[model samples]
Target chain A: MKVLVIGAAGMVGRKLTAALLAAGQVGGQPIESLMLADIVAPETPAASLPIDTIATDLSEPGSAASLLQARPDLIFHLAAIVSGEAEADFEKGYRINLDGTRHLFEAIRLSAQLYRPRVVFTSSIAVFGEPLPAVIGDSQDHTPLTSYGTQKAICELLLADYSRRGFLDGVGIRLPTIAVRPGKPNKAASGFFSGIIREPLAGMEAILPVDDSVRHWFASPRAAVGFLLHAAQMDTAPLGQRRNLTMPGLSVTVAEQIAALRRVAGPAATQLIRRQPDEVIAKIVAGWPQAFDAQRASALGFRAETSFDEIIRIHIEDELPPVQP
Target chain B: MKVLVIGAAGMVGRKLTAALLAAGQVGGQPIESLMLADIVAPETPAASLPIDTIATDLSEPGSAASLLQARPDLIFHLAAIVSGEAEADFEKGYRINLDGTRHLFEAIRLSAQLYRPRVVFTSSIAVFGEPLPAVIGDSQDHTPLTSYGTQKAICELLLADYSRRGFLDGVGIRLPTIAVRPGKPNKAASGFFSGIIREPLAGMEAILPVDDSVRHWFASPRAAVGFLLHAAQMDTAPLGQRRNLTMPGLSVTVAEQIAALRRVAGPAATQLIRRQPDEVIAKIVAGWPQAFDAQRASALGFRAETSFDEIIRIHIEDELPPVQP
Candidate 1:
């Protein structure tokens, strides 16, 4: 199977590409070739299979269509301006998040005569806003407070519409916040969710921007990549009319995160976390969903870590070296 | 207040226009001028104030901007291809329903410097699809099964986003199926909902396409106009981030409708209805929402007929002349 990964340079995209390469196949088809694209050229991985990398803005009129010249059997669209940036730059956010997704979908639709590729789109939990249910179910309405969330919700609608019209076979997965995100601190309001764990594990101080009582949903980076693969191969007929599903995630409060950190890295490491609440971040995080039923995803065989401790272990094994005695 | 009605020639648009003229005000501001637009020039109604009529497609590149030349303070966007036509013509549906709405919104956003208009958008209950709850609430997620519904859902998202960004003050009202419709039966699968009552009341036979047990939500043309007028004047602060709302409507089964018809128009009038099963239409109607909680719209003072009999009476009072014995 020939696969194309848009936003291939990003964290999840890179992880997904690596997983795809390691598996050597997608949906039981041997990988013949792989194409990676982003706003910046993605690094071509060392693999026996043919791999091509391109730097292009999919929102550009013909940029997305040009990528379809090869007509890969599977496409993973993970491209998006993160919440903070999208909320700050309205035009850029809509341009990249909303218009870019549409451009790619439109390109696939226009090329449907040749092939109908299985397209997996990455949506976000941000699609849910304030006035959330105590436990949000897959059936809850999307009332995004931020522009980025709005963009994601709109794209989910488009994905369903395009798929229903038979322009493409599409599946949209709303990913939970990836705990212990292996990177420098970012500007996302929820950045602290990962920052506190990642920094403390690295023997560095991390700021706790909100009260430990603030709870939210999460999954490991590995689970996210798994969702992409499963979505690519799943029998979407069972999904019926609703093409979007909220992926299974571990729901935990920040205090539980600290307790998990203490169990994993000792009290010394946990002490590296400092509480200095930032009201702006606190206000933003307050509106986020704390938990979801995610019954549909679980029933579909999609699984995630049941506890924050397992999440921490996964992060340590995946990103950290053995701790010194 | 100056007002612009984009679909001024349609049923709801004409009634709303007439209401505005009769009241001579919206939100307590006297009407200075009114602009009406449609694919065909809307007949300029005689009024004490200026009424400009123009035939134009809002989807055209500059067409929407041209309508904004006058920069009316209150804008009513009700232009759309009916459900049946939209379902039949895929490209036309997206072009008109999706692109047309975006053009108008973009036009408003671009012209934000001139003034922030109160935009009253006419959405529909079609935004809800199957797998619905027994009573869909304001928070029900949009999972439209039809292209027309998908377009409306997407537009609702855009409206909320635009309103959040302070580009325009928008209020989207999802109207119920209007009953006792004052027109010939069209191709909408739901057309028979009105046709059965309208045709029979006019002393003509009407076909019942589905079982009498088939239930759905509804409001009268007069009540629909009432929703528009109320939505235009209402304070949106209570709505917070969710700008779109499912307007309160009566939920009734077809059997109840027949009973109500008998109460208002006599048992002889009810006998004018004949049964004819249409599997295609039955399947279509089967997917529609039978009821809604609509608590938010009700709390905000947007009212509808409490019973189906009142709805029939409304049609008689507004559209039909005095019934002769």
Candidate 2:
């Protein structure tokens, strides 16, 4: 089997490529060739998996057609500008996230001259916004808060329609916040959810923007990977009109995250946290959904970490501990 | 009130312009200038009102900026390709409906002038497709069955987000089938619904594709204009996160239409109907949602025809000979 990862250089993209190599196949099919593409040339996996990596923009005219020329059987679409950049620069967001996804789908349709492939697209929980009940149900209409969310919601609509029309099998996974992400805190509003734990674990102080009781949704990186693999292989017949699935997530609060941090790294780590009120960040965070009732994905056999503690443990496993002097 | 009517040459556009003129104002403000734009130059009553017509392609680069330059205080965006044309030529559909709408909203945001306008856009029931309950509730997700529906759903999302940000105040009205449409049937699959009755009334035999029991939604042309004008003037404060709304409609099938025709004009109109099954058209009709729960739209003060009988009466009043004739 041949596999192509469309966003091979990004965080989850790199991990997925590694997981594919570690498994030696996709969906029990023996891997023959792995083709990877990203906006920038994907890092040659530090002498790990034998892979061919190329750099290209998917939204460029005919670029998707050129990318799909090799006709890999499994395609993972994970490329997108983050929320802040999307809201700030609408043109870039629509061009990359919306037009790019459409181009990819059209490429598959244009390529039906030869073959069809299974496409697993990474959507986000951001497709949902407020006026959402305390617990958002599975079949709720997509009311996005940000431009990025709108783009993702639009892409999901295209994916379902394209798949239903038989261009290719498509599964869109609305991933949860990847907790304990192994990196310095980024600009995402949800960054602090990981920042408090990550910074404290590293003996660095971090600021909490909202109240400790403010709840939000999440999933471990391990589970996000599982969602992609499962969606790529599952029988899409049951999906019928709904091709997009909200991946299972843990609805935890800042208080819960800090408590878990203190348990793992002691009270000293907890003491590194400071309360600083930033209403701008708080208001942005307020628009973000706290919980998701992802019954559909769960019923379809998708899995995730049951608790934030497990998510922290997964982070520790993925990224080795700091070496002592 | 300065009014901008996009797609001013289209059927609904022409009627909406007339209704706006009849009212002489919107939201209780005196009418000032009217901006009319379309690919085809529109017919404006410049002799009576301050009307400017521009033949502009909305999807072209900077076209939206050019349109927004007029700085109309309120806008009615009622442009879209019919479903069959949209499905047949997918790229054109996305270009005009999806990208065009985005460009318009973006232009509104970039207006360095502090002039924000109330944009009223026309959506369609095509946004909801198969596996539908007998009555599709207002809260259902837009599981569009066609590319046209997807494009409309995307535009609706953009409208909501833009409204949320206050870049523009907008309302998306999901119109029902405009029964007794005063024109020839175009490529839309539902065009047949109007075609059968219109042809029969014209003493011509009309083809019916689906079962008489097939139920679908409807509103008269008069009601549609009401929706547009209401959307322009309604208090949008109550619609916190929901900017898109499904308009009120009457649910009737072919059998009921024929019955209504018989009652209105005796059996002469009903007997002109022909039963010819077209598999392709039947399949297309099957996937569309049959009815709607338009509570939100009703609460906001939009109303539709009461029944198929009343709809037939409307056609007679608007399309048939006057009482003297």
Candidate 3:
């Protein structure tokens, strides 16, 4: 199977690509070749794994067509402007996240005579925002607070329509916050989720933005990869007309996360935490859905980390420096 | 009141314009000027009614910005590719409906640096389809069956977000099938709603694709005009964050419509109807929402014709020829 991974160089994109390569085969078919794309030139492994990397900005006109010329059998569209940037630069957000996705879908649709690609789009829990209840159901309305969420929701709509029309077989997975992400905190509002765990493990202080009682949905990075792989191979028939699914996730409060942190790293890890009451961040976080039933997704074989402790351990093994920072 | 009517050549657009002119004002402000636009140049009344007609295809880049240059106080967007055409030419649908609406919304958002325009967009019941209950309630999930419905749903999402952001005072009214539309039978699948009455009154045979037991939602041209005018003037404070509303409509079966036609135009109107089942068309009609509990719209003072008989009478008074063939 010829596979294409868009946004191949990003963190999750990198892991998903590695998993795809490691599996080496899907549906009893060994991967013949892989085409990877990113705005920055992606670095392919030196070994002859039959991978080609291309650097191009998807927002540019004709970029999607150029990418579609390769005719990838399986396309994973993971490219998007991140949340903070999307909210800050309004035009760029709509241009890249919304318009760029549309162009890519259009390109593949217009070229179906030669290639019919099955696409996997990475949507986010961002698609669900403020006015959230304690537990979100599968059919909760998408009331996205951020521009990024709005854009993602729009893309999900597009993906479903495109799939319905038989232009493509597509699946959109609304990923939960990947806890124990095993990296320095990025600009995401929920970065603190990782910061508290990652920094504390490295014997550094990490500030908690909200109270310990604050809760949100999470999944380990490994579980997220599992979701991507499963979505790539699963039978989409039972998904019926709608192709978007909220992936199974673990719900945890800050106190539970800290307890898990202490369990994995001992008393020293708990000592590295600082509480900073940031009302603005707290208010923003408050609106996010705390948990999801994910009943449909789990029934369809999607799974997540069982506990925050398990997630933290996975992060240490995968991301911690061999030598202390 | 200065108002701009996009898709001014459409049936609803013409009726809305006439209503505005007849009202002589909006929100207690006198009608000063109207700017009309469409792909085909509109032939608005030439008797110095203070109207400016511009023929422009909004799908063209920069068209929206150019149109907004007029800086009208109110904007009524009633433009879209028909559902069947949209389903057939997916790209064309997105280009005209989704992208076109986005460009116009963006134009209005940017134009607000100097002037904030009040926008009334004509959404359709097509936004909801398939897996619907016998009577769809307000706030039901949108599961559109066609590409056109998807585009409309996507646009509705944008409308809500933009309104929340205070870009424009946006109001999206989801209209029901308009009965006795004044025109030749168009390609719309729901054209049967108008067809049964139109062709019969014109001394021609009209085919009904579904059984007379099939029911659907509808409003008259006059009621549609009322919806536009009300949406233009009503207090939107109660709408809060949600700007899209399902307008009130009369739910009636084909048999009921036939009864109303008989009452108004005698048995000849009923006799002209021919039953010829086409599975293709019947299948399409089955998925649409048959009843809507439009409480929000009703509370907001938007109403439809109470009876299909009144709807038929209005069609006769305004559309039918004085001398029958």
Candidate chain B TM-scores, in order: 0.98, 0.96, 0.96
Compute each candidate's TM-score over C-alphas.
0.98, 0.91, 0.93
Q: For residues A1-59, could you state the per-residue lDDT of candidate 3 as single tens digits?
A: 88889999998889988888888977577888898899898889644568889998888
Q: Which order, best to worst by DockQ?
A: 1, 2, 3
> Model 2 clash pairs?
none
* lDDT: the better of candidates 1 and 3: 1
Whole-model lDDT, model 1 = 0.92
At residue B188, what lDDT does model 3 achieve? 80
Among the numbered candidates, top DockQ falls to 1
Give Cα-based local distance difference scores for all models.
Answer: 0.92, 0.86, 0.87
What DockQ would you assign to candidate 1? 0.90
Model 3 TM-score on a 0 to 1 scale: 0.93
Candidate 2 or 1, higher DockQ: 1
True contacts kept of each: 0.92, 0.87, 0.37
Model 3, residue A46: displacement in angstroms? Answer: 4.8
- Kindly give the stretch of ten consecutive residues in candidate 1 chain A with the minimal lDDT sum: A109-118
lDDT of 2 by residue, B1-325 (tens): 7899998898889888888888888989988989889988999663467889999888999999998877889999998887877888878998999888888998999896587799999999889877778898888888888888988998999898888778899999999989888776666678878877788887888888888878889998888998999999999999887899999999988898889888877797888888888889888888877888889988889999888888777777777678783
TM-score of chain A of each: 0.98, 0.96, 0.96
